[model samples]
Target: MEHRQLVHFLAVLDSGSLTAAAQRVGLTQQALSKSLSRLENELGGKLFERGTRGMTATRLGESISEYARDIIASAGKLRHTASAALGLERGRLVVGLSPISAASLLGKRLTQFAQNYPNVRIDVEGGIDRDFVAALHRGELDIALSSQVGGQYDGILLEQVFSEPWGVGGCVNNQALQDAQSISDLADGKWIIGRNTDLLDDIIAETFSNAGLPMPKPGIMTTSVLFSLHALSQSDFLAILPQSLCRDFNGILWRDLSDGAWISPIYMMRRRRAHMDELVSVLLRELKG
Candidate 1:
């Protein structure tokens, strides 16, 4: 019933022999054998059956193995949680970022977070809106910053931090769109679209569709803000960019679509009842500020 005895049992089961298990667990073969024997005695059952081939788990052993794994996993988690609580373990934070947020403010927030919590390791993964949300739901991300697509996450909480209007962006010196007044006016220009979720593309297409104009096929689809900006600045391609992002990019001129305004709400997602670690709370404050 001892933790070490359970570990020794699992090792022997995995290695197929006492000698191999002893070597792996850094114990003498006889010592490991005795430990297993003691464990079986304590549990009032035989754990393993020795045969010509190798050691095999008995029915009782098989039943116990499942519980043993859970016990060991829980013990490890307890140790980690305690260490983190005591500030003995340098924590790790995994953040998921949507493409637009990455372009506007994520980098600055990360820089400031790093300066504040130098001991905590921070990992940033960038993806489109859907992928980021999926990662958050699957527990692969500690937090996610992305646009709010109305949906319920049963055990997750979403906080709306800010809302920004969408705007049409193209080359600064594009003569073809100088007097563009509406979505219908941009019908002849090629559109540059961001891949994933298609939020921007859908809005653009809807604008043209509602205005009785042909929806322009996107000439380029990308997740990279830099690539999208480069394409917009050097060619006649227009992209729907968040107004905040347009403001961040000094040289970009944004024209509001007259069809109606598209407002994208930025949200912070985290597990609902989960404890917010100290570093995470600090980072959230910085983001909200």
Candidate 2:
């Protein structure tokens, strides 16, 4: 019911343990339990089911967590706004980066931002576009840099930043595929594909279908870029990777496809609000600059 109770509840939910949550929120375990108990009584339902290992949220807890986050974030934004008006800085920032951004220089910028704003707490998370957008809606992320994805983002806005081209990459030392210049040329080649790339899958399928070629089955499926790169080194498999990543990695070489260069448009995604937070504005300036 109180702001402190909600904060404690979130801490426990996030840490999944009473002792850890208490430590995180600077409260004793017994005190934290009392807060939770009072909250559950006010709400008339058990928020979490405790077990020997850790606590797990019940159905009510799962649904209400996002609302709690938004409420807490809104309250913090008010404080941050007041601080900014006095030429001071405060509050937390959670940023979500796409796979390509994670592989590029964005991470270094994050470090710099954290160092410059010592009063702020920043958390960086890595995931694909949809996942990042979902985090934004849940108030888990303040800003997200990710590839463009198609969906009904009712309360989200996407601002295009840049585009990264994709290429079919193979081992640099593979002489057999040296003369291959397009997707058709690698018709019979094995592929190492990343799984759970929903939009990228559509692009790949459409590109091959336009070339009058059926979509090739992946020889190896994974959700890791490192695994794909290592597989290319060990086998005759090809993969579609960000040109920036391919250009720098030794033992990897890429060629332009005759059909089209799959363009991954990177966007700055966030939940729509009446006014942007000061930390968000500062971080955007740093990234844009």
Top-lDDT candidate index:
2
In model 2, the worst 10-residue window by lDDT is 79-88
Which candidate has the top score in TM-score? 2
Model 2 lDDT tens row, 93-135: 7788877876655656777888888888787887666666545
Q: Model 2: runs farther than 4 Å from truth?
A: 1-44, 48-67, 82-92, 105-122, 148-150, 196-199, 258-260
Q: Could you tell me the lDDT of residue 27 within candidate 1?
A: 99
Per-residue C-alpha lDDT of model 1 across residues 83-200, encoded as one tens digit per residue: 3685613777778777666655655777787777777777888654445444444344677887734565666688876565787888788765677877788778888877523455
Error of 1 at 188 (Å): 2.1
Compute the lDDT of residue 137 as modeled in candidate 2. Answer: 50
TM-score of each: 0.60, 0.71
Please report, as a residue range, the 10-residue window in candidate 1 with the lowest summed lDDT.
Answer: 130-139
RMSD (CA, angstroms), candidate 2: 5.7
Q: CA lDDT, every prediction?
A: 0.71, 0.76
Candidate 2 TM-score, true structure as reference: 0.71
